[model samples]
Target: MSRIQFDSVTKRYEADILAVDNFNLDIHDGEFLTLVGPSGSGKSTLLRMLAGLEEITEGEIRIGDTPVNRLPPRKRDIAMVFQNYALYPHLSVRDNMAFGLKRSTDLPAEEINERVREAAELMGIEELLDQKPKHLSGGQRQRVATGRAIVRDPAVFLFDEPLSNLDAKLRKHMRTELQRLQQTFETTTIYVTHDQEEAMTMSDRIAILDTGTLQQVGSPREVYNRPKNTFVAQFIGSPSMNMFVSKLDRSGDRPRFVGDIDLPISERQAESIAARSDADQFLLGVRPEHIHVHETSVEESVRAFVDIIEPLGSNDLLYFELESNIDVTSVIGNSIDIGEDEQGDEEEYKVFIEPESIPQRYENSDDPVYLTFDTEYVHVFDPETGENLSLDQRSTPEAQTESATGAGD
Candidate 1:
């Protein structure tokens, strides 16, 4: 079993700079876990430590029952694919893929050749085996690099931004291919990337790191729907979450957020906020998609004037000015049509209505637009600590289980 464990691992450089602080994680066998964060967040540092390229300043790392803290890179039973592909220009793809096994093991030449051929076939690069790295495209070279690691058949696969060098379309394709390979091979894989979208789409679970500290760990839906903190809420989403600093007014029958504009909360939400904290001030958060726009005034709707509109494919992002210095954005999409499938399943097919076909457009309007917040989708945060106070109140048991932040617990 290739279950990996990191126990209070810490990395410190000169001048007492900590790269990874008390990092702890348990990667189950055959699980795909992605470590994601911004630059200088120590994600790569953790991967290097696991690969035995860096020394641990404190704590231990284990593979199954064996502690591997002192193991050399060659003895760690892990294969790493670097961002640059790291192919030998003079070597043919077959030789490049067979190089590690030839140097590290006593396998016969015939067996090595068979292993290389199998790996090449698995990567769908068998046709390019006779060609050198200099003649291959970027994506082909990436496949060769991955095929090289596959030939090793290690207990763990470590990918350090392996798809970063590919074009956007190619990167998407490669990630999908990699996911299929991991599922087929069932190796405990640890992937590191700065792209949160990649992490969300590809990982079984994601670990968010920042400045040598672990911020959160959860499934994609758990992290997206119920973020643990403000930083995570802003980092994992595409346009990020909109936040407003406001004071809580309890004098009214229902609690209301008072700032440049007033936003009333349901009694249940008020009770949850009161139970979570005693702070009178909070950072109110709502995703752009949750804010709705209407042509006329509705109950609990706020009046706003259009500031800007950005068309993004099927959806248009509308920015509005509610009051001076208070700007909000809402994503509006044309209505979706459900087409009947051959089997008469309406859920099988969905067609998006064309934006130009819509008669009433909110683009660059001078007239006031009424906005309403979906209270069920809203989040309340501690302004000083940045913690999400509403996470536990609304999160389901499955999400809570998938979102537990403790390491090896």
Candidate 2:
């Protein structure tokens, strides 16, 4: 009954501006969903509309069973926590938390105070409730802002990059706290952020937006392991998925992909590619963890030259140039020439590898390297439309896809 539905929602700024376009979604009651993308992706605009702070340009927005398109901000029965922590500078934590209740509800003073005290305690800011906003630390101020929203006990919670102001460690700590609070309250929440890490770590489902369109919506792992397009594939990961636009040509007796680089595919992959071979070119995506990087030559490995090595304690990301993918693109049928880089240069692609798997001599070295990707791990996308061409064969680990299943703690 607490579900929020957006039916063909569109937001336009001017004749030239299309902020949101034809958006449709059903957020289940008690679910935690996140809207994530780069700047100007309409996530914040979408949140503002849900809060009734921004008017809908077209279509309907409903809270449970009620149409809220014409409702004012105060009448929406929703609470929002902003990135800036909009606390009243002159008010103490207790006053800031209780202000909304006094304005919207005629609760007894004893009850208001009790609710304020309860929210303060829940946010671990009770000791600072009597102190002004200027007297509290950044984290404490954030807690106060969230506590203010909590006391409203609204049907829906809207967060607009609320943790963006905190330091890395504190932001991580508060991520857990917010999850715990949602679990305890079981309120439906829609959060907005540009941080894919935050969205992936905290959301029950993530809705990715680009330009003004909703790219895809699914569990973290489903999107990560089986992205719908090139944008989703590239945007959702840390190191970003390695990509190369190449042509797939039927080998004399087998199947393979051709670009600046050439790949002889496995039988299973060959079958999948053959089924979708109507396209002359495809965009290939491989997660960093699935690619094996090495210094010495290995069978079925493509020789490459390392470009960069980023170490992260647990794993190292290896960037290398794929000459075949870059060099042969000019020769692919009807493909636009990508202007040759010098004579031997190619585009760079990255691979995530464990340090133990790297040869010591090649460790941190950008010297010639050999790379191999498993057939089961790579995803194929249509070059023109960016749809997953190999959708049926896309695979993801169970542990990874279940990691962020429903948003509650």
Candidate 3:
């Protein structure tokens, strides 16, 4: 395994279109780094560049200490697993896995058999060694493809949506298998997938790409909890964070988040907001799990009309619409006893947002939902620039603090 580096990498297909723009990253040795983004996000192009399947239009890509810009795929010492199984239908699984080694070297027949047997065992496909690709199941075929890569013992492993074709159940099972395999092999791996869950669950660190630009690169928790901008915030979450426009106002010593509903801020947060000249228009972001429904009175709470309720067994998802027409979703635990008998009927529900839950408030409208967040859980972003304003570009401290506070709360 080796450390991979991309320095100011840019890939342009045409003069006007840029597939990857100024991409720079350092992937640690033996790390499983996942490149996650929607379609047309340049993840595939970036992987192809690393595999030597595509030319680098500009900048450099280094594997270990060697520059591999001019090296061919085979010479780069990298193994790539494509989305399709890409197995030879005529060859048996054992022969398929041995194809690369046989072509590259005239190793003894005994050594080739030993290597292929080891790879099949590692991938738990030893039972299907004699079967051809056409006779194998989808999962078995996938393992055959992986076994082919494993036998190479390359410096780096590259995967491009390797699980996209599997059924949901099988995909989940393979996810666990892949994670375990990575740990066992300890090979430097770069995986590209549009599935956010795959990226979150499988990667040691995730790099989010959008519109040919690297938006955020950090651990899964760091990117999810403290996204660098509104786009990252919305893209990373499943139910997506709730956002609204509100203005910041100073009421005495503390800055108050004034909207359709009014909420007070902490002294430190107030001071922070007060010092910022650009704090006038900030977006308020809160996760679905952070919004709570309280039967009892709270110091800071907003009155919202419950629009719909979706019972999801272990948890109930409550959807509410504020007077401003902004919809907010809250996930209440299954143990919570709420009046579900009045389902499908509009009713007034008391929504309590902790002060920390409220991120920087925007000043676009007065009729804003008074959104409060656990100060530790809040994420502040610039509405105009779409950049995070809470902490530095790296979100270590903020993410740790938020997670600890969230667990305790």
- What are the TM-scores, per candidate, against the unseen true structure? 0.88, 0.89, 0.83
lDDT of model 3 at position 28:
88
TM-score of 1: 0.88
Q: Please give, for residues 42-88, the per-residue lDDT of candidate 3 as tens digits.
A: 99999999999999999999999899999998888888888997999
Candidate 2, residues 1-409: lDDT per residue as tens digits?
7899888898999776989887888899999999998888899999999899888999899999999999899998899999999999989889999999999999999999999999888888889989999988899999999999999999999999999999999999999999989989999999999999999999998998887778778888788887766778878887677767667877667678767445777667767766765677776777778888766788878777766677778887777776455533432343222212234233457788786566555544556788887766778876656667676664455533433232111
The reply for model 1, stretches above 4 Å from the true place, is 325-366, 405-409
TM-score for candidate 2, please give it.
Answer: 0.89
- Where is model 3 more than 4 Å wrong at Cα? 274-279, 325-372, 392-409
Candidate 2's displacement at residue 285, Å, is: 0.5
Q: lDDT value for candidate 1?
A: 0.79
User: Cα RMSD (Å) between model 1 and the true structure?
Assistant: 8.7
Predictions ranked by lDDT, top down? 2, 1, 3
Error of 3 at 353 (Å): 13
Candidates in order: C-alpha RMSD to true structure: 8.7, 5.4, 9.4
